[model samples]
Target: MTTAEEIIAHLRSLRNQRNIDGMRRFGIAPTGEQLGIAAPVLRAIAREHRRDHELALALWSSGIHEARGLATLVEDPRQVTRGQAERWVRDCDNWAATDALAFLLDRTPFAEEKAHAWSTRKAEFVKRAAFSIMAGMAVHRKELPDSVFLGFLPVIARESTDERNFVRKAVNWALRQIGKRNARLLGAAIAQGVKIQRLDSRAARWIAADALRELRSRR
Candidate 1:
């Protein structure tokens, strides 16, 4: 039987000879833009080791793209640290990797607290990572309070004007998710969406409009 370590080593060996040029042909390359791995292969590798967080961390640090998928496969986010999570978020150069670690795995003990904090970060990817986790958590953890989701409205209201592709998308995603959770929150989200629309920016307008369209309709 291949122990997890042995399996990781084997995977690392394969990475050593990975054809970056060829991978790019298929829209997959070690761009090193965000932890340097393609999305599809990472998902596949994550599926293979869906239960081993320790192994996943080891694999993630290996700097192989597929290992990141495994990191997302980790079921227990508590195993990963805030430091490690932030490091990965900083390393993220693309949406797939940023969301994979932030939304999929790498759960810091202070995830909610950190998400709020990181939302204010200047780095595009890091800020998106924070909000992406907020979106993911809305779906992943149902027990969170209405106050918790309501709190995110201010973040969205402020960030709505960012217009940056990754950041706005994530902020919008978080807003939509909070709205979808229940009727009470839907009303709150709708109000915030209206506030966002009044902001003096195209990005803010779009964010509010799009979020209002969905959140209002559902309620």
Candidate 2:
């Protein structure tokens, strides 16, 4: 069996000196002095232990910034549990890690329920993850009803007032993705943007204004 320690050691060995500084320059804080390994290297690590859920969990829980990056490379999202997914989001302190794990989870079977449930979470990133999942599904899950996308409008309206950098960004992302899907949704999104602009909060105003501009565009 591939051991978690062995996997971490392998990841450590593959660390690229140049990439760690680049990651920090990009605003991802490093937990230590050494630069983290690249995604291709991490993906190669994940490929070796593809069937070992326990090993994968062990590698993820090790909490190196890049380790979580590797966690996303876990070819089978089903092998991961809700607890694991939720925990990863909670542990996320940066946008890159948060989106990486979210992208992985969004591709899985349980994505819809989890996305809707987490959008209601009080925690910023958890809610952000939920909305991010919705954004991904907007493009990928074509079988879903338009009503499902419509249902998220209320959450976006309520959460648009969230002034936190990450949360509002995800809210904007979800709204933009939904608006771009079709002409009818574009109109609905424009209406919602108007409503959001009228809110008392500055964050809400910006979100509404930004969304309205692009949503009204012909692209």
Alpha carbon deviation, residue 40, candidate 2 (Å): 4.7
Error of 1 at 55 (Å): 1.1
11-40 per-residue lDDT for model 1 (tens digits): 555553345555455544445422334456
Model 1 has a clash total of: 1
| Model 2 lDDT at residue 38 | 71
- All-Cα superposition RMSD per candidate: 4.0, 2.7
| lDDT of candidates 1 onward, in order | 0.74, 0.78
Runs in model 2 with CA error above 4 Å?
Answer: 1-3, 30-34, 40-52
lDDT of 1 at 118: 87
Kindly give the number of clashing pairs for every candidate. 1, 0
Model 1 spans > 4 angstroms off: 1-30, 33-48, 105-108
